[model samples]
Target: MDPPPPPQPPQFSLIPPSQIPPPQQNSNPNIQPDSIPNWDQNPNLTHYLDLSVPKKRRRGRSQRNSALFRSPLTLNASSNNDLSSYAITSSSSSAAVAPPVSFSSIRNPPPSLTQSSSAYDFSDEIIMINKEPKTEAMIALSAGFPADSLSEEEIETGVIPVIGGIEQDKTPTEPSKPGVIIIGAGLAGLAAARQLMRFGFKVTVLEGRKRAGGRVYTKKMEVGSRVGAVAELGGSVLTGTLGNPLGIVARQLGDVLHKVRDKCPLYSVDGKPVNPDMDMKVESAFNRLLDKASRLRQLMGEVSVDVSLGAALETFRQVYKDAVNDEEMKLFNWHLANLEYANAGLISHLSLAFWDQDDPYDMGGDHCFLPGGNGKLVQALAENVPIFYEKTVHTIRYGSDGVQVIAGSQVFEGDMALCTVPLGVLKKGSIKFIPELPQRKLDGIRRLGFGLLNKLCHSCWWSPVDCFSGR
Candidate 1:
């Protein structure tokens, strides 16, 4: 008979409760709330986009199809709140919710490597003729297993013999809790989470809505391609370099691009064909309006107030009066609507400073989604991450020791947590934080305005070129 094989170290196990403490929130006046608009305060002008609504049934068939199967999926078009922004509130320790029941008592699975002595022995599948290195032995054992998800115990001791996939004896050294708690699951939150995750701290992302990818919705519809495709119902344009990490990641992992047509025929506000040359007049007038609005924002400097894009355009009416056909105003309105969606709100609400930071004019080529939509990037980010659908993180607590995160009454512990919630939620005082954040951080977020940028994704079929006023 063959001799018995060598023994391996203990396998990974969940963190014990004795080591964890009760939940708490650190809030005070020092952590002032953000002055930006809240989600509830935002408006929904895009109701016309939802075809399922009873009123939309009145539209013609072609218009319905065009809206439903719109070429550019509205995913990530930001059909979300326009009053989005982060805020930090000051408060003394508030009420602490009970810890998740299964948090501490959850049983850890038996060590995979510590099974019965007579169990099947792990065999090595050698690729090379003579693999003598112990590294090779370790690699052979680690096949088909996740390395990043391993426990701290496994990462440190390294002695645990690998079993089916994980090192049982090892446990992750819990991460530190963060000062600030963020809410929402938008691009901004994702970017912040990605950055903070790199640090040795934990983040709690409290998302009020059931689904993630806030405003960047990518729904799979059975249309477009043979197998059907994912379509966007929100913001569809991505311009500039740094402001568009999704564009880069898409090209790298998905090898996709927004294939914008060489030229989109100009249309009158009333949907009539128009000459692109005349668009120069439109662009010229629009430019001045933008410039004036930008200057207004700079002058205001603080405290957000609302402004209307339509009103701004009114000042330039006389400039195009000579070319004014009956449909000129309608054409102008349609163009303005598309631009409004581009910014997700009126230029008046848009922070010129933010725009400059996100995508400076003439800096790089503007980007759009693949025929499917920008949801591809969100799907890619979620591929390996351990995310729960419909899961909502409620409270976040961090201290000198490890981090604690509460989601839908379930508390999860980790060496470090990365809170990737949107700034809007943070501003609203939705989730509680332990150890009040420094005033500097609070002030930064306080001043950082987050206005809502909502979009409605649905479609309207082609109606008469002049539906309202007879042509």
Candidate 2:
């Protein structure tokens, strides 16, 4: 028989890059509701305990060329933002001569014990979930958190969740702190939960969205003549696989990686591609400029312990002031914009160290998209994990033993808590914390900035290109 078909891609409604799903048509044909005869329906705590056998490491597999590129961007030549940090291209301007403006920028489950079988045990819980009462009682019973308020001073300070009464039952042997509360069901929070779960600790995740899977987004698109393909609108590319734990998880979950190309799209100011033959001189000059950038990078590295990318770049500009022609300078500057945007943030706020940390060369990784869009990875991760959706945290108070969280009048206590809130939410002070946070964490919070990225896809059923990256 011919090979079977894969499941239909999800009907992603709005793939939000804002740090955080849709219609359902049964894609499978011969599938019956009772196809899996022995699936479990109740909440089975035991299933979560099942662990897979660790894969043995090969002798010299070169660690699959980790996405981390210690090599410099000047060397990679592949101009696609995929290989750069933060996918920060374009907002960087392929237009070097153009003035700086603003710009924004998974799981698995096991078989054996199924959800149906657990239904008997969790029947009441299911009813409770659907009922949506003031979650205070559930949080009280599930986490032992408090319902107290916090001071404005505490709100201003960024602090990690403190340990208190919620930790009373917590043990060092456990993977997670018993009383820990994890808010937000996206990749960061989920990853924290997975790590904690490995230590055998129970976790509570409060998701503001009605669904799990935070920023990794996918949506239906009129991608050329193709009716549907999972196009990632947020958190689209994977970087630094060699060291990025997330990248590793992505591949294990079967995400697809698209190679980034160096041949940049030349535009005629109106954004249409310029004829290659006509643009050959400029393209070749762009290539020569790459050579100059490599030398500049080396010079900057030798200059000082503390220097910003812009400063170093300025120095480089001065060095080449009288060296290259004005036309060449325009092309050279444009390519630098491409390099800086790889991190996707304001140029003024960026630094050489940030680029070094993002390190796209040695740390430079091959770029690719998730096969079914990043949404697939998110769903796989959350398939069977416990997530309470549409639950926004309101107040937090810490006691001698544990931390308490208040969400819609419901209280939960946990030994430790992980709040993977977006920078925007935290800045707005939407959720309050008591006992005050330390100054250090708060500083990090204030200093760190979140970037915005947008993609507006259409039913371009008749486009010349196969896929669009908005280059």
Candidate 3:
């Protein structure tokens, strides 16, 4: 029989906790380091990007497998608040003395490895790591894994390994808490930050746009003699009231939300009211088309093929040629336009398989909307959260230690990072990943479609002699 395989080093998981300590506003009145820290004075900050450790080819299957091990520490953040940047101090018994390394200063390296700053700054928080010997406990502890998560042998040894180039902490009493970096300051990002902060995480939000409200925009309009009025330009309505996350938040924030009125008056091209019988016929035709499309979609699913709703509608129109005339067909198309309007996409691009997907609670029928618009939702979530705006993140690099985000010349580092960018932006391939994403994920990104919906809000003056005069 083959001999038992050699033992492998304990794998370190760098999964960031949901929360850390809430980030307190920077209390240092004299110092303002909101943007990238001034690294010119301390060139050592640039060394953080260096991979000086030489690579070696491993011989056996065991060594080869170990070589392939990659840490899951890739916390990617966008242009914004991610986490607290702290100082990192390292020391060795063999080397008589060495300077402490700052996590923010990792981008630079000093000319001499032996030289280190003699003065210690306790005010600058340090990530404490014990330096003894490489063991399962050490790797687990360094990555912030709980003691119970380890095995019996790992618990017994309690050895701590020192990563190369990075020195161990002189004091191990106070271990630095993990932090999370959130990209995007929209509703989801801000909401995530709020929850994570409550969980005791130091959270930072980065927004590429100047404002926090991602796609939720509210526009104000004032016409000739009319007073001010607001219109929802994005994400207007709440699908339901019961168990609706947005509705719950609106209630907590004391915002007014009313159920939308479903009634709409139909008129002819000449501005005359359409006959009630013609309206009923148009409505009936639309309903029939929807039913036909559903059946066609079911049949297409059996063949493992997907088609657009527009394609299905055309097929329905072809089959029910005598049901409606050209004018009636146009009216039916107008009613069905709501589907495209709601999705901000055309039927030609919408997937028939998932186009009708919606929450079952919504079927109960009352759709609600905020009079002030969805921007109120954004404001409620972004409260107290620090957001860095206008910083376009270009790249994210993660490893066993932490994640580093690069936007322009600035670098934001944290234990974990969350990306809340729009699917449209991600599909553009503007931001690049370090190791590259898997093929299936990239394929999904391509398969998924993004749509654009335009809104034009304006006020018009009506005179008695105008079209209304005919009524």
Relative to the unseen true structure, what is the C-alpha lDDT of residue 359 in candidate 3, on a scale of 0 to 100? 17
Report how far off residue 426 is in candidate 2 (Å).
2.5
Better of 2 and 3 by lDDT: 3
- Pick the winner on TM-score between candidates 1 and 2: 2
- Report the alpha-carbon TM-score of model 1 versus the true structure: 0.44
The C-alpha local distance difference test score for the whole of candidate 3 amounts to 0.50
lDDT score at residue 372, model 3, on the 0-100 scale: 57
lDDT agreement with native, every candidate: 0.39, 0.44, 0.50
Give the per-residue lDDT digits (tens) of candidate 2, residues 1-471. Answer: 988984332121221222110112222222223231111321232222111111111111112222111111111122332111111112111211212211111011123323323211222331232233332222111211111222222211111122122221222354433646898888888766654554466877898888677776666575455645445666766643433444544544434455545355666456777566545654454444333333333332323224444454444444445226554444544554554445465444455334433221222234444555666667656654578888889787877788888889788888767889888887777888786667887787777765566676654445343344442
Error of 2 at 105 (Å): 31
Give the runs in model 2 whose Cα sits over 4 Å from its true position: 1-177, 222-227, 240-247, 254-262, 272-307, 322-330, 349-355, 360-363, 460-471
- Each candidate's TM vs. the true structure? 0.44, 0.54, 0.55
Q: Please identify which of the two predictions, 1 or 3, would achieve the higher lDDT against the true structure.
A: 3
| Error in Å for residue 297 of model 1 | 11
Candidate 1 per-residue lDDT, tens place, 338-412, comes to 555444555444333343222211213333445556665565543322335565776778877867777787776
Where model 1 places Cα greater than 4 Å from the true spot, the runs are 1-214, 223-226, 240-243, 262-270, 274-278, 288-363, 398-403, 413-417, 434-471
Worst 10 residues of 3 by lDDT: 54-63
